[model samples]
Target: MISSVERVRAAYARIAQVDRPEVWIGLRPQEDVEADAASVDARAASGERLPLAGTVFAVKGNIDVAGLPTTAGCPSYAYRPEADAPVVARLRAAGAVVLGTTNLDQFATGLVGTRSPYGAVRNALDPAYVSGGSSSGSAVAVALGIADFALGTDTAGSGRVPAAFNGIVGLKPTRGLVPVEGVVPACASLDCVTVFARTLPEAERALALMAAPSGRELPALEQRRPGPWRIAVPRPERLGELEEGWAEAFGSAAARLAEAGAELLEVDPTPFIEAAAMLYEGAFVAERYTAVGTFVDGHAGSADLDPTVAGIISRARDVPAHRFYADLERLSALRTRALTALGDTDALLLPTTPGHPTLADVEADPLGANARLGRFTNSTNLFDLAAVAVPAGEVNGLPFGVMVIGQAFTDERLVRIAGLLAAPPVRLVVVGAHLSGQPLNGQLLSLGGRLVRTTTTASAYRLYALETVPPKPGLVRAEEGGAAIEAEVWQLPPEGLGALVAALPRPMALGSVELADGSFVTGFLCEPAALDGAREITSYGGWRAALPSLAALPSPAALPSLVRTEGPGLSPPRT
Candidate 1:
């Protein structure tokens, strides 16, 4: 391992070599930063266990870092912090060295990195393109290997879009999970202190150190969702207006995640997409003005203020409190609807942005270009969801990425699901009680089951309603006159599945169920003995379609019978 001083020295050396002036807004005198690093080495030498010994990182200009001016990208607004923010203080205590503060959109108000007087943060890979923002500089510093990780803020896509463009990891923890005590807020209630790193481990390590132990009002959620994970994504038809090569890139990215053992469930993205629009277009922008409108107003014609940013805040200042409250309620409803659409799924995956925008693209139409960039990102914080953006590969030779989103406080678990995108898939088919919203559906959700898609069996099988206590289905291969029967293919981890097999009761058995697409998966089958006088329901196509006929049947003394529509499962379908 390199000494702290050596690591700090190397970071400065790389910064010099990269020669990206726009990337940093301030620097702690090199000697002073190295002195801090030297102390870290001394502590470690004295047998201290420093978790981040020799680790060097950068802070977004908007965050407080004592001795360095917090310009937040506008020189007129710069001020020296008396001390480090709690998040920074925590990281520093763990033996990490702070190189300096990086540039950002003035007051962290814009999604595009261009809205800063420090000049547009050029893309690390292609200077002509944007680096993504308002975390622009921090992301570029990490992508260039100048810092092991960097701190940035995300109220909208500021933290994620930049990571997608720079080919690194960006973790925007659940809102309020990381304290915003000393950081400048674009939206006080919505801002999050985010981490950017080269890999998942590094990002997770830093976040683990800085995160508040637990006072956030998050529900008790699982961190490790066992495999055959369900990953939600925008339905193909809804992925509107992509750059030339992005559609194909999204398709390939989704396909790769499926290969990682995920069941890609294409879902309606209406609530999320609508929420994204609200972040900037509705009363939400009022939060940004509330943050620094007076200062910008006082500096009216100062060159330090980005005209685009000033214009946005100026317009937002007049928005009445009623509109903000109305939007807040609407946002609340959208959040509920969004999570409900997810059902038992683990996370929502999306292209970090429509595509990488060139500096020229921003110049042509700053608001339009910036708005387009946030299409996939702006909704996250508004809905109070945690997100991670990782490289998905390339789009027309530019860096691209996909974000995994989950309920608030699922940071660690979300990372686990993000990692499981590479696990081998374990597909299973269910014909009756096991189908989605059925009486027995919770059995699958408890074991981390995911609905791959609602499909049907080949035209060579018969589906029968077996008379079990609570009723079940028996799928039998037809000798003749076979008809296609509806079925649902779900995925589960090997262990959870093995347990189900061990607990199999009566004549119900597991066998290969071929789908209409000719794909075979482990599904429910019936023993000949259990088929005695069973009613054939293949004519109904699926159990859901035939459920009306079975509604009158009484549930067993212990187990409830299946209900029509979505049933009473561990998680009912969100309305």
Candidate 2:
């Protein structure tokens, strides 16, 4: 394995070789990145497990990273944060090192990556093509291998569109699952932290580390037991606006899914389209205004603001509060109707974007092209859904992608489906301390493990509360009496399996464990002798439920605050 310090050096070397200034707003000094890598290395040397120990990542400029100036793609609006965004902080704690902040559409107001004052981020595959935005640089950074994965914000299609254009995976998590505490809001209520990575597993891993504690009960995810899935697609007429060859490309992808046992059902897209239109055509625009209206209005005609962004915010000022409320009520009705229309379907499959636009194309019809890009995506967050965009194939030598979407909290299900559609990796089932938000979960994450879904083990094993310092679990196969115990299935890189197995403590060992659905996979198991003095807790069903004390641990988002005393000293623009 490459050391973290060497990985950081290689990333810097790649950046120097590419010399793409437009892809970054402000980068951390090389020495700083090396220093971070050294710290990670020291931790590893001391036997501390780091899930993302050698991982390099970049953050969208709108997200604060303590010492860096957050420009949000507008130089004049830059501000130095006293601490890292909750999402960034979580990633760092998981062993990922931040390279720097990448560029985006100014204030994250546009889908076209071209609206930034720092310069339009060009497509990683082709310079003439426009990098999809407002998360432009973050996607480009990952696609170009300058970073292993990058953080992006998705209010509309900012995250997915870029992943499509760059032939990568973009995981737009459910809103509030990943906190937006230190991120500059584009649409405060709709904004979500998104992950961009070359592989689906990598993106999913990042998503797991950043998930926040949701206070309310969320919808249950679609079952993971492999069988036939009913996937919904828009009617032919609804796809009529696709660019040349794109419709054909989409059809081929659907056909591939069918071959993989998916039943494609065409549905009316009216409700979805209406919900999408409501984002800009209805009072939702006021939310954008609510985020930055005061600042833009105070600086009216300043040269610092992008003209398109200024115009969009200016139009929101005239929308009366009553009108906003009316639209909100209308949206509520549409959302209910849309959910009803999608009844019981496993997932909705759609093109990530209607087409890939060129820099010249965006210049010719900026707003129109940008709006088209959001046709299938703008309604996702509005409808309270989760989506994962994966590269389907190429169309006319340009990258194209299909998005897998489901109701909110189905993020892991969507990611699992996406992995199945692409290339399935080795899966490992974890029972106790290795689950997300657990004390020892970092060990799995550092080894490139991603949570697939939380399910139960076959009713043939007994779970025991081991007498350990941090309280671990011991699972033993029982022939006569056993109960299905809650467990989380995770995808792990095959290369890391040996190391993971070798590092297991006394009671735990790698063995085949059957899932509730009778599917078997390599997982953690315990020798019967190890459970001699342990308390049998199979009645509790899962480790989490059995240990009430674990509930008091702070969530990933609520970890200790890190206060930085030094920054780039960029003055905040006067309003």
TM-score of 1: 0.72
Name the weakest run of 10 consecutive residues (lDDT summed) in model 2: 561-570
TM-scores for all predictions:
0.72, 0.73
Candidate 2 local lDDT, residue 53:
84
State the lDDT of candidate 1 residue by residue for 233-325, as single tens digits: 786569778878777777887887787778889788888888999988999898888899999889999988899989998889999999989
Report backbone clashes per prediction. Answer: 3, 1
Model 1 stretches astray by more than 4 angstroms: 222-227, 420-575
